[model samples]
Target: MNGIDIHNYVDCNDMFRAAANFFAACCRCAVAEKGVFNVAISGGSTPDGLFEELVKMKDSLPLEAIQWFWVDERCVKPDAPESNYGRAAKKLLNRLQLQLDNVHRIEAEKPEAAEKYEKIIRTLLPLNKKGLPVFDLVLLGMGPDGHTASLFPEKFNDLPGDKIVLKVPEPEHILPAVPRITLSMQAINSALEKVFLVTGNNKMELLKVIKNGQGNHYPAAGIFQAAWFVCCKPGSQD
Candidate 1:
């Protein structure tokens, strides 16, 4: 089994660079093999820096051939302030001048949005050996409370079985709580590559536990075959 690999950095700039390099590689590999690169991005304060770095990659990579997707989303209007789709647009997509059709966003506000988004994903992506739609790359962020995407600690083991996408309601076990739609574990694990962008001292202890392999109890550790780009205060041991 491919386990999680951790890489620590002194600042987010280096972290974003590493992620952008890995991202460029995934894009090239996917495009060469399938003519399109499917990418899913998580919404958080951490990935914003990575997005900024990626926009500058237009000169070095095939930016136009890349298609974008969201890893999870708040159940709000697409243009809403809290929407992940909105955040990504402001941070990177608009800057890239990507063909608007290539940026697929989840209509999280619709009553049937989960099913609708799942259909969109299925129609847009190719399947892995496991018969799941495999994204070329999936970028994630871990909550200080140990959640990844919207699979919170409170509902870690309870994500929907048959659905490719799940709806998460705010629960007492999580902080910064809100309703959300997220890919299921099976869907996320099927990615060709999974990269986590972790930053700040707030996550230091959590990263320690995760590195020590004590994070199985937390929702964030459920993602498989992942690499973490961590930036934190000094003296934090790997």
Candidate 2:
């Protein structure tokens, strides 16, 4: 990756540990400096291990100073199995005793979920010079087809530049296919730090395309100054 920093690990466990440690470090630093650590996290099975690892470190983390937000959400109730907030809540938040108010989940089932989420982000996060909310950290995951935070390849060109959150009503081909609400590319790029957690041997070839910078059509490739925490070693097979 021309503009990305690559951190390779031998396996999924190692990769999750490294990413969790990185997240903890960022949380401590941000909370120490500004009294708050605001972060937006992506959904998917890939990050579940990282969430579990973080839960194990609950005693050391400044849970009170951390504010949680989601990068995107499916159009389902919070209790649904596929819901990102639901997964994190079960694996991490509930374990850490994080207050409900600090968890800013996107209510994707509502008609104005995107607008409501944008308002909440603006209210809680500090804005940069360009007036974009700056999150202390943004944890992301890249789909096998190169999508990130619900930004798919088919509608890459049609994404709104001025919006903080976008309502994705047409996600017909993707798994768990349904409506979604996601942060715009502008919102993601404005974050102070962004990291992508990529594991599994099946993703090596797609990672190659991203690393070579030939995936302009892919949403994950367009992220600004991203660090890739990858465990899929070259030549590894399932």
* Candidate that would win on TM-score: 2
Give lDDT tens digits, candidate 2, residues 191-219: 98999998878877888888898988889
Candidate 2 residue-pair clash tally: 0
How many clashes in each candidate?
Answer: 0, 0
Q: Which tens-of-lDDT digit does each residue in 53-115 have in candidate 1?
A: 888888877777888998999888888888889989999888888898898888888878888
CA lDDT of each candidate?
Answer: 0.84, 0.89
Off by over 4 Å in 1: 173-176, 235-238
| Model 1 clashing residue pairs (backbone) | none
